[model samples]
Target chain A: MAPRKQQEIFDATLRLVAEKGYDGLTVEGVAECSGVNKTTIYRWWPSKAALLGAALIEADVLGFDPPDTGSLRGDLVSLVEAVTRLLTERPSGDIAVAALAAAVRHPELDAHRFFADRFAREREIFERAVRRGELKESADPMLIVDMLAGAVWMRAVFRGLRVTDDFADAAVAALLDGI
Target chain B: MAPRKQQEIFDATLRLVAEKGYDGLTVEGVAECSGVNKTTIYRWWPSKAALLGAALIEADVLGFDPPDTGSLRGDLVSLVEAVTRLLTERPSGDIAVAALAAAVRHPELDAHRFFADRFAREREIFERAVRRGELKESADPMLIVDMLAGAVWMRAVFRGLRVTDDFADAAVAALLDGI
Candidate 1:
């Protein structure tokens, strides 16, 4: 299938997942919603889980590595802003939620590892901050990253609020300074 | 059914919801797991959503109201610690994730409202802190609460980390003074 057509299928898959949750999504449903042939979808991917995983990767939903801005705060703010935009500006957040739910339900899936790797990569920003003496030596980079990202995710995804730049700034400030 | 037995049924419901996504869970499964009569469950709850909602309420998963501690940091520390304990000390987090997924997949469900009310109640702690002049008058209580709770939830729930008292203290310090 053409890349554009593949994108359409992914878009449809995410849309359905967003609207129906992961359990409600199916290959037939994706084909129907995307106007793509079911056989074509199967030709590319073997199962629903594989299709969903591929769609997530193709959509770059969980992919991010914000460039360092020479300061921890700047990097975090930029990174969070990008994440906020990614989760809120499109169907990526829904895709992520579906993937998370699916991972929990089906422990055999690789989606858990994929997200864990993404989170580990996210922690590197904080690791850099610690190395630059921008953070306390005792600070757990993983915890700090979790707190910052968690705040954004909770507000935007769970609480259904628009994650403003000001919120991101405050979050980074809280992480760097205390609150 | 006896209240104590009702608790067992609720426990079973949550356990199944946690292990299987909401879509994979069924009332029959819950009945089989709990050894409760299906008719008895049906008598108390009208639908699967209702059953799940009741199970959550009975489990008291998101239920908590941190008392005033004369300072914003103290109050937040207490609040986040309690939330951490709630999500970590038991299977409540999985139940919560299941309910969240169900709510998202089924828009008509009342789980969203239930959690929204819980979040609103959580905001009250910040409201009290602001009233006591421990926090800035300009502070958005909702955002503050979101960040604080988000950090804990993200760590204990999503990342599957044990949220220690020390970490909670640091979170509060960051929120109060800036990290």
Candidate 2:
């Protein structure tokens, strides 16, 4: 019930998922790792998907402060870098991939909701650009975000390729200035 | 072992994966559906992931002719449309999502190989564009492909959004002329 206790559970869940993957993760493992009762976890989260989703959200694992970098390119590069880290970094990347995999089989996982929430949060960068006359009023914010993030996902997750240091800058430039 | 029989097995595997998610798919189900011996399927494919991968390859479910349209923009739109169909269409889309989900748990699935092979096959389009002076020699072909395909995957799979008819042209235009 306490915030500290919830953080412990969330951390334990992410750690277990990173170590054993989604298929191997269990409420019992979270319980054991976090020193919380399995009944308590279930009472709070209801199911493995629910538990994982809550942990991902409550732990702020995928959270980032949307940059207000003045220029659209600068803001986009920051956003891309943030996404690159989430898809390439340790526990977060592993947990995110595991969640994506699990979502395929379990629609109740509501991975789309996670992405939707993120897009909604990031929409402000584009709005700012449009207001400043930096971007067209008709620019599709969601599509732009999807293309940028999707490129990272394609390389890091799908291709098993490294997200190089220059990728964020290069991607933003290519998308913004055209190849 | 014959080509015809092998086709039957591959079709059955894809169908089973489409009907049941990768987690639900089994060699026995494939064998039953294909009217093939379970041992034969096992002897050839060895594992479920291998079987699924081979089925995807042998079925040519993801295959498309590289458009030789006179212009690079036209070719890219064609490629985007092809990718959209693969990600949004039935049986192929279902099988693809299932394979991708399975790949996350089973590294042996080698989904990267599938993408690699596709990229290799499509590389000629860029090569031709360069030869025709349609594209800059400094252009990153793989990044271009990844960004375009990534956008499709983001909309179709990640967001569960319908990739509209105009998306291909719009995306190509955005990437080519800058947003």
Candidate 3:
């Protein structure tokens, strides 16, 4: 397959997965949507999970380049806000839930690595915060990241609540100052 | 169908969903596993999503009754600990992820209500805490609940980290004392 064709196939995978969810997605559907041959897709990606994972990375479905806004609070809020936007503004949440379910059912898929890599970049804000003395040096960066992101996910995804700007501000405040 | 038959079918549905995930599970498979006919299952549950919801409730997949441990801290730890046990000790996490993905794919199934009811019981601890004057009267009980549960889920479910008793205590402290 040509480089351009491979990219087209990945783009098609993202569109199909986002629209149909992972289970409803098929190699044939990708072939149809991308105008690429099924044999070629199979030759490049052995399974639907593989195809989806590559598509996620290549398309930057959950990617974020956290901006350094000088203040830890500012940077953390932006990082979390980006997550909220991905989960709420786009079809990324559906794709994530689909991948999560698929990852649980098929352990070989290793979706955790994909998310962990993406989330690690967001964690850099905390490290910068500590250096700037915004947060206690002893604070655990991973825990802080987990708590902030987890709360957003719980409300927005699991509980089906809107991730409003007010909610984002409250989350950041609660994380910074004890509730 | 007899009451005993209904229980058996639900049990079978849980077993199949936990084992196979929702996408791979079929009404025919449940009937074969339970030794009940597919027609009977359809009569009881209009769809696979409905059947899985009922099975989840009957199986107590995310069920919890937290004991009021006098302090908000104590109760919160216990509630999170129970969530940890459910997600880690059993195949309940797989069931939850399965349902989450299914709910996303089929909006009419209303898995949110199913989880809302189960999670509402866990929220009672926070209510008790507010009543005891352990937490501020103005605190948003729902947000508190979301943060606590979300942190545990991020680590235990998303990060695939061990939700140790120590980790549970730390999570409660962080929520109470701010990060």
Candidate 4:
């Protein structure tokens, strides 16, 4: 089967898992939802964990659109806005928040790699900013990324705080000052 | 039932839930862990969710034994160190992280109020410094606190980063210099 077919099946499976807890998702359900065969699903992923994990890593949950703005500050503003937009948009943010909550319960077989693309992107963004001299040379990209993303995640998942342009500005400014 | 007894039962439940996911926990399990009667467990807290939420809030997971050091930088250093110590202490952090994870999936019933402490203490520290004139009057305490805790939590929970004194200092320095 083409990888696009695999992507289609994975997308459907994510929606199923997000809507219905992981326990509620099934290969049959995914196949039924996506018009893909169960055999095709199994052939690509050894377990449901693998299938879902791959989707989170590859699928743009945040669609984490990277900023090409001339400076790190602009990049940060752009990133926060995108993140705020993603969280405000239905289903994507809900799925992500739900998935993170679920990941802890099944730490042994979490459907997403805690160490994959998302984390990597965070590091890369900060490092790139440093390279561009957008931030101080001493700034640790990893820590900066963690602070920015962490605040957003905490607000969305814990406080259920709505993101606003003012919020985005404060958070970006905090990053500017805190960095 | 004494509130203290209720507190103990809740503590036991939290540890149990952390060590053994929600599926593995029970009222009887908490009773066994805390040496309280099964009757008392239900008497004070009607549901596991209520018990857990109360325990999570009262346990002071984010409590900081700040050193009251004279300087804002020093105070923040002390705060970060305390946070790191708490995170590394054991089942407390583990259970706190676990409960938060669970809360996301079961949002309706889960009202983990860890952020209440986080934000409160955060504002207190920054505002105190502002009053002392150690920090800019314009400094946003909420933003500062978010940046500090956000960096630590993101590293500890998401990235599995072993937060060290060095990391904390770097974070503090980054924030101080940025401002």
Candidate 5:
């Protein structure tokens, strides 16, 4: 499929998910919304889970390139801000929440794989921090990432709280400097 | 209604949510499973969300008493362990996931109320820590609690990771001592 065609499908998938959630999303709906034939969509992605997963990955919805800010604090703040945007922004935020809710009911969706892939990509920031001697080599990268992201999830996703402008900076400072 | 009868209804609600997720849960199924009349259930609860919310609250599914462990680290470790058990244990864990998923689709469920109540109760631990001079008075209690509980949610609920015995201690240490 052409890149533009794939983008259209991905956009439709995200839009549908944002509007009606994952359970309401269907390949037929995607085809109708995207103007793509069902046959072609099935030929490329076998299942609804596959289609949604591909849309998320191809759209770079959950993954972000680790920023090289030359300092651990700067890099972490950037990463946290990226997560804040992902969870607080439209389409992406709604799609992420829908995906997470769907994952609870359908383990076959393999939400863990998406998180794992994103975590792997994001680990580079921590690795560089350790190499730069800014972080201890023994620091658990997964824990750090999880705490930061999970705090955002709690505030922005779980409680539906308005994330303030200082949230990213404050979160990074708390994690790095201790509360 | 008798205490035993209320317990049965709550139990049925939780069990159904565990087996079939929240969307699959219904008052009729709960009534049938619990041997309680649907009319009687509705008279008291009024709606499915109300019934589920009552069950969660009356059963203390999400709320835990703040541990008075004499020190900040001890209290935080205890709090983390409580959250770990809530997310990792049967019935409660499954019910929590189902309710959270349902909350995303149905904002009327007021999942935030449950979390808010839980957080409000848990804040006492931090208050006590400040009184004991173990934590700074300027510490953001919500952020501290959110980070600790959020980390456990990330490990146990999100990633479905096996929480080791040392997880609570390690998480608390990381938060208090900085990563």
Candidate 6:
């Protein structure tokens, strides 16, 4: 029951967003879909943004934290593969894209906590690489992280560009080579 | 007169898409708004997707093709600065964000030919550098470009991330250091 309540909310939230998109998502709709009361939903989260953010946090999103493999290439493949898989899989990319678009207009609610935290986590991963000296001291780890993260997302989500395994290998090779 | 006619159509197309989104954009709406006949619009392009794609291309905003400044650092700066300008100065990012979203549904027409081609062009610029020994021979140009473009669009468009020089600088620094 403990897990059920939380899972219900997150599952319901994902489906609603996927089906209706961010604009059509509503607390009322979530409650109706999940069979949870609106008051119960609000008690847990201040608003729909909070609820949605919480859902993303709660969901296993293929692990945003990049793993520390001894080599930079190993670590990158781990990072890129996970992100690539996420984007390639159903609903994750779509949900992410929709959430981002919605956040633009409702920045006060969506921007402050969840979004900043996500960026910080991304930076934290890169900073670790810098500390380990797996990368150049002058290299901007955030830039590297962005390059990896950005390419996959832009291809899959935005431009609908495709990334093959050969492409991924090339990407890993290029970043290591260039930086 | 020649430039103005095309400009009017592009302007009207943006307004229409922004107001009604890509799905709602009509040849009729664009024609009426621009005071150009529907026949004229159709005679120029084959479909609504064609019209929209032309508008994006007409805006000339696939971001700048990076100029060779000898130094990758300077080249990177130039590239980032160019994108930063495009992101801030016009509704370029917004239109792009919209196009990507639209592309998800209308894959062939919008994403592959228009946006993806421009994205590919940027990758080619970097890849050639690799070939010239300016960058690492093994450097994955396509992947790096994906990251560079994705990170910018993700932060600015999705997160309501501001297009500050500092942001671009940080991104450039991070990318150079990390990758």
The candidate, 4 or 6, that scores higher on lDDT is 4
Residues A22-72 of candidate 3 have per-residue lDDT tens digits of 667899999999998899889988988888877766665455687699997
Scored by Cα lDDT, where does model 3 land? 0.75
Task: Put down candidate 4 lDDT per residue, A91-162, tens digits, no spaces.
Answer: 677667656666666564453364456666656567777787676666666776766776777676567766
Full candidate order by TM-score, most accurate first: 5, 2, 4, 3, 6, 1
* Candidate 6 RMSD to the correct structure: 3.8
List, residue by residue over A2-120, the lDDT tens digit for candidate 5. 98899889889888888888778999999999999999999999988888888777775554788899999998899888888998898778888888898888887777877787888
Candidate 6 C-alpha lDDT tens digits along A69-116: 766677777777877877777777666666655554445446435545
TM-score between model 3 and native: 0.87
Better of 1 and 5 by DockQ: 5
> TM-score of each model's B chain?
0.77, 0.94, 0.86, 0.85, 0.94, 0.79
Worst lDDT window (10 residues) for model 6 chain B? B58-67
Candidate 5: what lDDT? 0.86
Evaluated against the true structure, the overall lDDT of model 1 is 0.72
RMSD of 2: 1.9
Highest-TM-score candidate: 5
Across residues A1-120, which tens digit of lDDT does each residue of candidate 2 receive?
999999999998888877777778899999999999999999999998898888776686656678898999999999999999998888788888888887777788778877887887
Compare candidates 4 and 6 on TM-score and give the better one.
Answer: 4
* lDDT of the candidates, in the order given: 0.72, 0.87, 0.75, 0.70, 0.86, 0.67
lDDT of 4 by residue, B1-179 (tens): 67666667767887787888665678889989889888877887787777777777665443344467777888788777766666666876787667777777776446536676556656666767888878878777656666677677777766666887597787787777762
Which residue runs does candidate 1 get wrong by more than 4 Å? A1-62, A127-133, B1-16, B24-47, B54-62
Ranking by DockQ: 5, 2, 3, 4, 1, 6
Instruction: Please tell me the TM-score of chain B in candidate 5 relative to the true structure's chain B.
Output: 0.94
Q: What's the DockQ of model 2? A: 0.75
Model 5 per-residue lDDT tens digits across residues B1-179: 99889988998998898888777889999999999999999999999889888887777445468898788898889988988888888878988888889888888788887888888888888788888888889889888888888898888877888999998888888888998
| Model 2: residues with Cα > 4 Å off, grouped in runs | none
Model 5 TM-score on chain A: 0.94
How do the residues A1-179 of candidate 1 rate in per-residue lDDT, one tens digit apiece? 87778888888887787777666789999999889989989999898888877776665444577558888889888877876876676567766766666655554445645546667667777678888988776766666666667777777767666776587787776566553
In Å, residue B135's CA in model 2 sits off its true spot by 0.8
Error of 2 at A151 (Å): 0.8
Model 2 Cα lDDT, one tens digit per residue, B1-179: 89889988888888888778777789999999999999999999999989988887668655667888988999999999999998888878888888888787778888888888788888999999999998999998888888899999899888888999999998888889989
Q: RMSD to native for every prediction?
A: 4.6, 1.9, 3.0, 2.7, 1.5, 3.8
